[model samples]
Target: MTTTSYRTAEQIGHTEQGPRPLPALGVQTAASQPSLVDTVLPNGLRVIAVRKESVPMVELRLRIPFAGMDRLHAARAEVLANVLLTGTERRDRAQFDTDLAAVGGDLSSVVDPERLSIGGSALASGMDVLLDVLADALTGAVYRDEEVARESERLVERITMARSQPSVIAREALQKHRYGDHPFTKEMPEAAEIGEVTPEQVRALHKAAVLPRGALLVLVGDIDPDGAVAAVGGALAGWQSDASAVSLPKLPDLTPGDVRLVHRAGAVQSQIRLSAQALPRTDPGYAALQVANLVFGGYFSSRLVENIREDKGYTYGAHSYFEFTKDNATVLVEADTASGVTPAAFWETRYELGRLVLSPPSESEVDNARQYAIGSLLTSTSSQAGLCATLVALGAVGLSYEWLRDQPMRIADVTAEQVAEAAEKHFAPSRFTGIVVGDADVLAPQFRAIGGVVLP
Candidate 1:
């Protein structure tokens, strides 16, 4: 038998000097602009249709501004989303699934504090069927008592489980600390509140908040753009209301303060959440800020990960990302570590945040971040589903396909100096405040020694 000789994995991965240098990122190029139509129906629903023929399937996303100010709105809204597709006047739950499955389609609805979203997919040949089913639910969901009761019980159980998680506990503490009692902070409602949401309340909410006006519908796939818009308009003609959907009230501005140390009794692990106000996507400074953010901690290779995770072994992972809501945006840095390492991780996180502001990024670092920002954007939109989701997000902020088509050029245009300026202006240590959730008994001494944390 003849055997082929081969190098071991370690041998192939290194050179005499050290590990091999990574190849420089290639010249970034823009994707070809897709054929598209964007128009508002007479009933005030904006329809965006883009023809992406990569696959013989279509993806759909519908977003309605579903914000409400009442204290119990979250609970009611969650129930509504859970049962929205359970039954319509035209079809019950079984029939609804049967009809969509017959056309190789499925749809799901979810709600957050800001909006109610419906997403679905189907073979391109069954696009019409998908739209029909969506329309049937939007215009005719009955909110049957049995369906409401069933979903409520299930939702309460889920909420109970989720609230027990350390991450959920940390997030709740952060939101409340940042924006006290704001409707937007109530992302997950109380289980007791969910248990009390009656079917009549859900129906009332649907009738009042599920209006077509001010909502957006996006469709991307192997279909004619113009024809898709026409189909949507025809199918949803009955999903009309004289009033527009409810938008969340503007969020209160965040202020810098001492980080709150929240006590989670009996917890052995800890969550550190840090946040600071940042520019929105619509801001002219956003591109430069985006690059700076990537360099700081937005990706696995970022400085925070390299420092706290790779070097110090303080946490398994660390990340920083922007959270956008309505017209406001904020950057959040997060890490989870054992109770013993939590204080060290928090200190290093704060150090890195300040370092980005004072030291800024080197020219080489800025270039790498720029390449990553542009490349990730291109990769995210390379598929039909991705493009559809992107359009929905951009549309919510009043941007269109043209904005997306030109985003690469925008990222590429950012200079190192611009990125540095953004870093200094936005990422100062004094600008951030957040929470650390852990066994305070274990963390209080170290955190107090560190001097910026407000212990419970």
Candidate 2:
């Protein structure tokens, strides 16, 4: 084609693939990683501080381990998170909101089986006020009856809607398949229990589970690390408790087994969620396995998406990711499809899983995946919000700023052979147990033909 005949991408932007294979990626250079200052206050709270002067804003992340004694605990904890900021002992809900808004700040709370997280942000100059407000809430949340009642009703409505969704049903069934009756399997509480919860129960949970002994706080912004630490230490001096926080117990290793068919009565679609045990970030081979996951199903250009979505058109989307727990991690794959095509989609998924382990990915595939893994991390951490969030997660796994700074080089150095080895060890179809949530009448016959499916 001559230059005169060529058209811009706006005119002809489709099918950029060439007839020949693409070249492998070469070495990558990155900007200098940021410096971090960290300290553990005498009260045993870990504070991580980083100076990012690019923006005049500050970000805060706090994670506290929240353990429940029984299934009822989930319901109570959910209510507590919803109302923790509604009314402190001194300020009413409206006043608290107004004060935070005055400083361009906001705080929100989220509770799960693993932990209770409080994420907030403010202007750089309002940093001290934000910390003071957080300290006040920690020490003196009132959990008023009227506020609790209102939030409780709203939570029940939200949960009921969530429980009816196909994705939620599939996720709940998958957790059950993996962990049986473990407390972690209960993602949402029973609506009836949530309705019965009183304000008193929430206060009790707050007393028992919201201690600061094992909490992690990550602060990033355009502030001096030394002064920020001192300010935080002074503000939170009274937010201490004698009782130690309870961390979740270590989960048992994932065992590969038969597929389970969960019958969703009269459903027109199916959700397939599958998983296998995976290495944690601390593992020596984790970086390579991350690259391997990207090549398999972690990205749009992956082999799994190519075979299942683009080629076969079995589903609109398919995604696989790693879920990290305090004790371990697992690889998860999920896709939803028409009820009639569910069996074909599941078959292709398993076939791809087997093929990933049977043969190594091409050199070009390895290079693309490796670069994606490295590049995404750099882009994510360039902002204060992103860096602080990443810091909170890394701290949960006992990693530090040095680890985050070195990850790009580690990912860039991963070779095709390393990714292949990690794939063979972790991606075998036989090593995964999965669930098919759809009409049993439509799915049972097809799943039975393939064998290894247990009916319930």
Candidate 2 structure quality by residue, lDDT tens digits, 1-456: 656777654345344563234354466665465656788888888999889998999999999988776758899999999999988878889887887898899999999888899999999899988998898888899999999999999998999999999999999999999998887887789889998899998998888889888899999999888888898899999988877778887888889988899999999999999999999999989999999899999998889898888888899999899999888999999999999999989999999999999878988889888878887898999899999999999999888888888888889888999999999999999899989899999889988898767876
Over 4 Å off in model 2, which ranges? 1-26, 29-33
Looking at model 1, residue 233 earns an lDDT score of 85
Candidate 1 lDDT for residue 403: 86
Give the C-alpha lDDT of model 2: 0.89
Cα displacement (Å) at residue 281, model 2: 0.2
Clashing pairs in 1: none
